[model samples]
Target chain A: MSLNVGVIGAGAMGTAISQCIAPNTNKLLLYARRKEICDDINEGHINCEYHPSVKLHKNIMAVNDLCDLKDVDVIFLCIPSSVMRQTMVQLNDIVSDKCIFVSTAKGIENKTNKRMSEVIEEETGRSAVVLSGPNIASEMMKNLPSATTIASIKKKDLEIVKNVLSTPKLKVNTNHDVIGTEFCGIIKNILAISQGICKGMGINDNAKFAVFTKSYNETKCIIEKLGGNRSTVDDYCGFGDIITASTLNVSRNHTLGIWYGQGVYLDEQTGVLFEGKNTTIVLKEICDKLNIECLTVNFVYDVIILKKSPKKAFYALWEKL
Target chain B: MSLNVGVIGAGAMGTAISQCIAPNTNKLLLYARRKEICDDINEGHINCEYHPSVKLHKNIMAVNDLCDLKDVDVIFLCIPSSVMRQTMVQLNDIVSDKCIFVSTAKGIENKTNKRMSEVIEEETGRSAVVLSGPNIASEMMKNLPSATTIASIKKKDLEIVKNVLSTPKLKVNTNHDVIGTEFCGIIKNILAISQGICKGMGINDNAKFAVFTKSYNETKCIIEKLGGNRSTVDDYCGFGDIITASTLNVSRNHTLGIWYGQGVYLDEQTGVLFEGKNTTIVLKEICDKLNIECLTVNFVYDVIILKKSPKKAFYALWEKL
Candidate 1:
């Protein structure tokens, strides 16, 4: 059975998903907002914006209109969370009811405080799977091996997702906790920023270890309170991703954190989009509303909101210690 | 009230501990096996072998004889695990029971499979405290801020250990799970080697996450079976240290794992000691006797004992996955 695959969005994650799916499937239709990107992908067999080095698989075809994917068996949504709801609503009017969605975007809707998958289910009335880990797009394009988890509420959908996403270079495991998995993907970014702050502040590995310990404990508590399995963050999406994002020099959030720690304004940084900045604000608000004692989040909030230097933020933390 | 501080070794960690304690204590006694090291410290006020840049505090007095520390209130044992028992025996004959011991050495005796803290308690008949985390001696000596946990069986002893160890740049948290804390410090080296193997084998962050997840789960199970709090490893000494050691390029165990992963013999490498190699064999034997199923340990055993390549080791792991 050759399932029809459609990737919505021409972002790095979408391109990577298309590349991974191209080898296993008979047809891969990639939907891009810009007509030129779709044309380039179709005619040149390359995603010039995201993955331009390797030639895309011949099975892939690009479509400019969402209606072109009316028969897609599975659609991977990689659009940013800000426009996810509007896109999903528009997608619901065109795509068939049988289409399954797998979201790679990691974020919570500020307006509703709902996860991307939850928003997907609400807007399109379709259950969606989430795929996330310490997936750095640049490394994946270099053909380096990596692992991620595909989580779905349904076991059958999870198995199908595993079959579709897993490759020799990209190992995909099935996770039952969609909420926990999604939360892990989002919360790690904030923690990674804190790690960068630690590094920029000239903190040693021993101190970083303490900060991570406290952060992970707080993350577990939030996961459990949200009616999700606490162990999800302890695995790939949480512990692994957080460590990679925080410690790896090239990570955007980490870089931003370093700049922030060094007293550089977030806007002054040129070539990076720090997801942790937004996540920190949203998460801090949530924590305050729920009375969750998340010291790491508060410290990050002080840097991002209160405009405190890394030294001052650390001094505040020392008082609690 | 002023306390008498005695550091049992003049190695990097011993020197760092002495440096941290020098500003707080009234009398700091550093005991070294070589009389020349003691003479150099007392005369020149510098431990060139360990920390060359930092001048020793004038209050520090170095002594070569063990009997000189008999009246000391606290002694930090920082000698290597191979010589721990012999050193403890010598100290026990001289030091009074009131002189509490704080061990920073992280290792398990091959003959007894007992942790360093256990050995200290058994030999000296004193309940000792353990100081462990990602305490990189070189970084600490440079006054780079760091944090670690101080664990003891008793709350009173834990408080005293915290007071002795906690400095402005070095934050110390108290833990009651001494068994779990000690095991975390010892086991992380083996796990770090596994991480290095992954990096050497060209494995991506995804696969590494899976490996760590399984390793941590197995560790928690083992800790629980050993009658220790399972959550102890989830803190600084376990998760924090393991991640830092594995990811950091400077870690010796990670470097050793990389060499082994690349098919270099253990003995072929000079100026490096891989504690994980010995830990793998000893821990495997321990797990076997206890009927604990630890896949990561078994994989490491296959690599070291069976002389399997990373490719073969991962292939075996894939079957289980």
Candidate 2:
């Protein structure tokens, strides 16, 4: 059951995922776009930039070329969603035909609104496995107790990915609802930003959680409309991740929302990429096309994108409640 | 419609609720059992025992006699669940037959496991509206924006109660799922304690939220099995209150779980009532009777009532995850 696993990207998530699965895999080839990071990882056995304190597992080998992943049985695409399609196209050309792709990116393709897995399948002609949950990369790097949900069309692929990913300290739940699993990751960003906006606006607990409750239910509705089970929204990727991102300060999207809520708008030079801003725009379009009304999405859209006053948007939201 | 309103119990919640509805009512009579609290509220325009800083509305009158509520059109029973039945029986003998009763207590009857609404119905032979949400009394006292859910069998009663309770700052949503609304309040205590136990045990965020996701789904399952709609758990009472009590320091149930999780057991002589302890014992019995397997319930039961090691119980729970 020991498989050759390739993890694409050398960012915090990529390094952390590589560390988590290295013990279970025969060889974990982590593909870093930068030659320097690969050299650092291979020579010193440390991802010094992301995780400096801990030594990398012996089974993990960092590679600068995507061709090094050709022999891998599984590839975890931990790259950003903006680059997911291009990376998948390159990996499709290099990797083995039997290699199962796992998507950890949590965004829909801008304009086309295709999910990461959809884009991967269109490019690679294979259904991609989706991984998501309340997994903080720092916590995962430390091997603190964590759990995640993985979804795929093929049950065997799910079993293989589950085995590759799960440890006594890192639990993995498997399901067949790819749409629900992927969208949970996307929708959670909106939830995080919405909660963050309320927090930044100094909204009370009762009102904040009430809006949050509405947002949570609206998520189920959106997922169900997209042909996924409503019950899937109760899984780790949905309830667990939404709460983690919205309530905790770990998420960049939540922080972005907080800044907008407090009337401090960051310019493009801020350096932090907020996936939620893109998500909010894409989801608003999706909801409009589908004739669905989500107050949470509208609230975030009004405040973040339209640059409307948070108080005015909040008052409008309160009126509907 | 300036209705005559009466609020029983001058505790934090009762006083806060009275303060919220006082402006909308013709005469808001807040009933306190103690003469001293009533006198203080009446003479000083404040419930000194519960809300000292906020001045009581001029329309709000503090009364000590149950008979004082006889002329009221609506009565909000904000007393402890332990004394709910006897108080309902006493009110049944005094209040007008047309008086609408609102049960704000969030606990079930000890032996019968009857919901507060059911107990009020059994004692008074009248349907009682149920009120619940992520309401923090201290926040509500400050006229902070808050929201709540109210449920009753009669649609007319729902309308009347909604109008009586609704304010610009206090938003109210109405539903017909009395069972779901009541149980959401009852089960949230369990959720709060479960999350608190994880916090006290210093379990990682991923595992804690993963278990919380399970408990939340199990709540929907239990409610549906008890003849309530599963979707009701998505409402303010379920999602809102669960997050509020579990995450915040406002709930005594959560604090109790933290103590047990930390292995610092407090004697019963400590004045604070851990309603969640009674709820856990009762819910365990109920789940056993209904043949429902809830890991969250079992984990809390092991750590608190059975005095089992938190580490052992957590391991058992994680194995299932």
**Top-TM-score structure, candidate number:** 2
* Candidate 2 lDDT tens digits, B1-321: 699999999999999999898999999999999999999998999888778899988988999999989999999999999999999989999999899999999999999999999999899899999998889998898898898999998999999999998999988989999999999999999999998889998988888898898899899999998988888888889999999999988889899888888888879887767888899999999899999998889998998899899999999998987
Worst 10 residues of 2 chain B by lDDT: B265-274
- Winning candidate number (lDDT): 2
Model 2 residue runs over 4 Å out of place are none
Fraction of native contacts, model 2: 0.85
- Tens-digit lDDT track of model 1 for B1-321: 668889999999998888887877879999999988899899999998878888887778999999999899889999888888999999999987788899898888868888998898888888899988877888787776677878998888787777777778888777888988988887787788888888788776656766777677778888887777878887778877877787888678888778778887677446556677778888888889999887888888887667787888976875564
Ten consecutive residues with minimal summed lDDT in candidate 1 chain A? A266-275
* Clashing residue pairs found in predicted model 2: none
List of chain A TM-scores, every candidate: 0.95, 0.98
Report the CA-based lDDT of candidate 2 relative to the real structure: 0.92
Best model number under DockQ = 2
Location of the lowest summed lDDT over 10 successive residues in candidate 2 chain A: A266-275
